[model samples]
Target chain A: MFHTTFYIRRLHSICGLAVLGMVLFEHIFTNSMAIFGPAALNGALEMMELIPKPIFLGLELGGIAIPLLFHAIYGVYIALQANNNASNYGYCRNRNFTLQRWTAWYLVIFLIWHVGYLRLYTKGITGTPISYELLQNYFQNPVVVVLYVLGMFAAIFHFCNGITTFCMTWGITKGPRSQNVVSVLSMGLCAILCLITLTFMGSYLI
Target chain B: MAEKKVRFVIERQDSPESQPYTQEFDVDYRPGLNVVAALMEIQKNPVTVDGKKVAPVVWECNCLEKVCGACMMVINGRARQACCALVDEIEQPIHLAPARTFPVIRDLLIDRTRMFEALKKIQGWVELDGSWDVKDAPIQNPYTAQTAYEISHCMTCGCCLEACPNVGPQSDFIGPAPTVQAYLFNLHPLGKFDKPKRLNALMEKGGITSCGNSQNCVEVCPKFIKLTTYLAQLNRDVNIQALKNIFNN
Candidate 1:
């Protein structure tokens, strides 16, 4: 019954905001604890580790993995189909239009490397819970640090810009004035998140 | 000083299948002359600035006003009504081209069948069972009626489509004009009976979901229709329709 593109598009948006967005928020916030030094960061990870393995696995699989997969895959299809003429029609919204798609493409690669290297490969190989020590060691690599910096910015922009469009898509912001307000608010949120993330990364470099 | 002249670089196509090329012309300038008038002058002489005699540029217009959307073309890189595009207001070497969103029939003329087809798909009319006159008709809220009146100004021009990145050779989007029309018709008391039908059509591919909401449509719309607002309203309506379909089925 939900076979139409209309439903599918809405479902994609729902997955992005309801599922992926929440997870990203939690991830950034938790990781930001690293700015307080290893003890605070380890404390946060230890708290997450308190959840039972089965429940954690279920949450990861259903809440994060499946939805992220759908969002990325469907997102790629949408990106490929887009005919971006932002070069010709270089209006502010049009530039954002092109940037949204480009950022999606970047996130696909960044996510694969970020999640794969950390979540799957590291966890699989080390056979240890992710802790401050692990991230500290991981961020020791200058290349990884650069990658993470760029990746974080891309993710933040995608999510924050996404909030504006999501509002429009679901009929939240109806007019140009309301849309401008929402865009400003969303960008402010993006900036704050970026600052927190940068502080988190700074803790590693030192 | 020499006689005032308006320079024009008009794009011409021999046939629908032929390649389009630009031809420059000099139209003797007149005060308050519009782009359509400039084209008319060029048609009379049918000669290029380089002194080559050629077939008159083919274009379409009626009413010579902005009300009829027939005279719409790209004037100086913007899709607008040539009738209202005054010569003095626009930059010289006035660039004229067919609104490329629709297939170019020839020269500055384009085939707007796709827009009409989209209108037909949306059932963009108040359907009445019979011509029998009725004494009592439901009154509409003045506010709602005003909004509907604003949306009703759309003349099926392809300017919105021309400016839209989504509606092109690469995409299947029905574009903003028809979607706004769907909202316009659905606002009517008599049109409410077919709301389900219209919403279902919008639920399909190349429908409301196809809109990327870059908002170029609203920016280019000559009628100043609140296209994005109506689109958002329809987005809400169609989602409600989908939910109804789910439980009712």
Candidate 2:
């Protein structure tokens, strides 16, 4: 049988990398209001609206939706398979494996509910069909803003952890050379993601 | 100050089919006493805590450091070297038993031959035809040297096997220690010459595919060796081997 770790970890990496790139683009375009002007941001938003709703939703569901579900499900299978539980290596030991799996699940559930309420339902956050104006109207709620902020950070942490683990899983990182690199990158990714997230959330808190 | 008494509850087994029982003893405490040292004290004077004469406790030790992994046993429910487990650090009435992952040979001794057998199955070595001259070997990078050095630190202590859920009496899984060793040698630039053979061995029954990825082996390894990481790599390596076999056929 094909080893699931190879396929599942690679799947997570491909999906996560694509979503991260897309989210980064969206963030830059939406927040261009302060950089250029309200008119510039509106122009960018109008261009985004030209894309068909079904196509956009399909991309969101396929890219952000399906891969995550498979990643989390297979991630759990791998965790349960490896657990002997005879000895305790402190809570931190092997916890990242399980934590990453559960966090992926949390992200999926959070994303589905938030997306449906924010953009899909008629009486949802936008309170109208998903037009550029509706999208703008939805971001006005502080709760939605906070949830999205946290969700984004959660995604960042989840992706970073997945990427680092993926390297090890694929044997890209091995022995002491790659071992040291994995350690540095694992911590580095977490720190950078945390910083970027704090920067984004800090604006709202202030 | 007068010496204080310490209690020990050690489990004894005559053979694989024999029943096990606990025997308690009291030893005179010293400033730098360890479990092995205390066992030595018991060996010198074989007597129970209840003032009855008995056979001396039997155990194994060497190197007195953790390097050899020969003195490995269950101390207070933790698998580690008895030579380094300080008496003071352990809770009172320190319990000692042979590691359950392997067949017990006696009181605190286990047959680690199974690990060696598994190593043999994986052919955990680099095969050389002796055709290449000794001095004509290719130079390796410093990075490769460093990682090989870490992987070389493995003492085959069977800690990873004990932690692995797939390795048991009922299961035929070869466990993680041997597989990691297989990867270690196979990744050697010279060793890569035998990569196909190694990969084939890993792809066989009780090979790399048997690993469930619970990552318990990584957690319990005292050397902090990356067992799961290597196992995953072996997965990919075996996949390539499978394709090559199909294409060749």
DockQ (Cα-based) for each candidate: 0.59, 0.13
* lDDT (Cα, 0-100) at B128 in candidate 2: 57
Model 1, range B44-159, lDDT digits (tens) per residue? 99999999999999999997878989998998888899999999898888999998889999999999999999999989988775777765778876879999889989988788
Model 1 B-chain TM: 0.96
- Model 2, position B6, has a per-residue lDDT of 92
All candidates: TM-score? 0.91, 0.64
Minimum summed lDDT over a 10-residue window in model 1 chain A is located at A80-89
Q: Please provide, for model 1 over A1-206, each residue's C-alpha lDDT reduced to its tens digit, 9 standing for 90 to 100.
A: 34469878999998998898899899998999998889998999889889999999899999999999999999887776677877657787778888888889888999998778888888767677798998888888899898888888888888888898898898888888998999899989999988988888998888
In candidate 1, position B78 carries an lDDT of 80
Q: Please list the C-alpha lDDT of all candidates, in the order they appear.
A: 0.88, 0.70
Colliding residue pairs in candidate 2: A82-B214, A176-B147
**In terms of TM-score, how similar is model 1 to the real structure?**
0.91
CAPRI classification of candidate 2: incorrect
User: What's the C-alpha lDDT at position A47 in model 1?
Assistant: 93
- Candidate 1 interface RMSD after superposing interface residues: 1.5
